[model samples]
Target: MAVEVAATRRRFTRAEYYRMAEAGILGEDDRVELIRGEIVEMSPIGRRHRAFVGNLNQLLVVRLAGRAIVWVQNPVALTDDTEPQPDLAVLRRRPVPYKEREAWAEDVLLLIEVADSSLAYDRSTKLRLYAEAGIPEYWVVDCVAETVEVHRDPGPEGYRDVSRVAGTATLALQAFPDVELTTAEIFA
Candidate 1:
């Protein structure tokens, strides 16, 4: 005769995740983000990832000045169970700083994720999450493939439109048609 045992897993809400951070249960050094009620560890930023993010930030800041706010590696609240810190978020201009409150999907014009090792996760899970949250535009910069995947027209099933660009091809946003950059400029 043998005895049987059952194992269960507990899922957390966004509020609980914040409480853990406030209580010092989660430290500032912890590279983690909440996704669908699960705390997922973020990949360490490599030199390539850092450099690309910096370059994009500089370009975006110069181009989008006064038109929108460029947020770097900051969390954007998606839902009660999901908060993802995208590499770059172009937010609608607001009078108050985001420090007063977290940026929500409604406030975003475009979201960019510079992906090297985390390309798959960014394309799949993160993509679905963003689409479900109704984020208008999402871009995944694939360092491995040296291509940029653009997603737009978010729907419940996922993004209705998806495109890829690389090399000298230029990328533009539907929200900011004036802002355009070539793939070379992005991955440079």
Candidate 2:
């Protein structure tokens, strides 16, 4: 008689994930993020995606100014097992510099992901993760469709409010409603 045993998987903590980078197990060039204790390889950023991120970064920095800090392509430590490097993260300005400590979920005012090819993953997996972490606001910019999907009022079940905007529609951050950007400017 033959018996079957289920395969087991090992999950790494945030410290272990960093140790992997320090020990050369994972290089800086490797586009990956720790999601629920698992290292997930991120999709390669295309030209359009890169452009959108850049535009958004510039626009946010100029508009938000001293109100918030615009962090681009940096990791926000949501939990011990979940650290995601969002494309653009609008963080609450504080006396303690980010160099001294990483941005936590609570410090995030807005998180934006420019999804050129990973729209599905961004809308589902990342959306749920941010919502569960109480990120407050999240935006998934779909490059192919030239639209922005906004998610707000997060709960354990996910975002309670979700909406999509395209064309010349004005898009504003939930935290900073005064700061606005148009879909045309985003896709341009």
Candidate 3:
């Protein structure tokens, strides 16, 4: 029997990704998902997915401070090997962000991913990646299960504390306590 090793390709830089986006090949609404070193075509966004994202964005913006901007569907640059476009990113407001330039992980305060069908991938692959970057907070909105998986205390290995916020449970932001959002509102 012969053993074969899988070869992984290096992820493209923000500049390179912009080139591909500008090339008009990915399409306007193709639902393509990208993470560390990989570009993937994600499952189509259903109505539930859209609703959840919209609601979360509004809640975060309303509850959080004005200086903390709520970014919707933007690529958070982690490294040359990782750039995952999170669904909702609560970042410190910058004069120029995805509005002018790409937002990097350093700019991010909280990263969120709404997972319906991609729950496994979100918890396993994406979770580790975000932790590796030492993001303060990471939320995985598991639509199917109707739960919010909050990852905290990020280290090189990954997030140490994994809390499941269900029902009326709330997630308080590290920088903003007034930014209290309900688990139901997010899953709804």
Q: Please identify model 3 stretches exceeding 4 Å from their true place.
A: 1-11, 95-100
Per-candidate local distance difference test:
0.91, 0.93, 0.80
- Model 1, residue 85: what's the lDDT? 94
Model 1 per-residue lDDT tens digits across residues 30-87: 9899999999999989888998899899999999888999999999999999999999
For each candidate, give its TM-score against the true structure: 0.93, 0.95, 0.86
> Which residue pairs show backbone clashes in model 3?
none
> Model 2: clashing residue pairs?
none
Ranking by lDDT: 2, 1, 3
Candidate 2 ranges beyond 4 A from true positions: 1-6
Q: What lDDT tens digits, residue by residue, belong to model 2 across residues 1-188?
A: 87888885788899999999999999978999999999999999999999999999989999998899999999999999999999999999888999999999999999999998799999899999999999999999999999999999999999999998977899888898889998878888
Candidate with the larger TM-score of 1 and 2:
2
Between prediction 1 and prediction 2, which has the larger lDDT? 2
Q: Where does candidate 1 have its weakest 10-residue lDDT segment?
A: 1-10
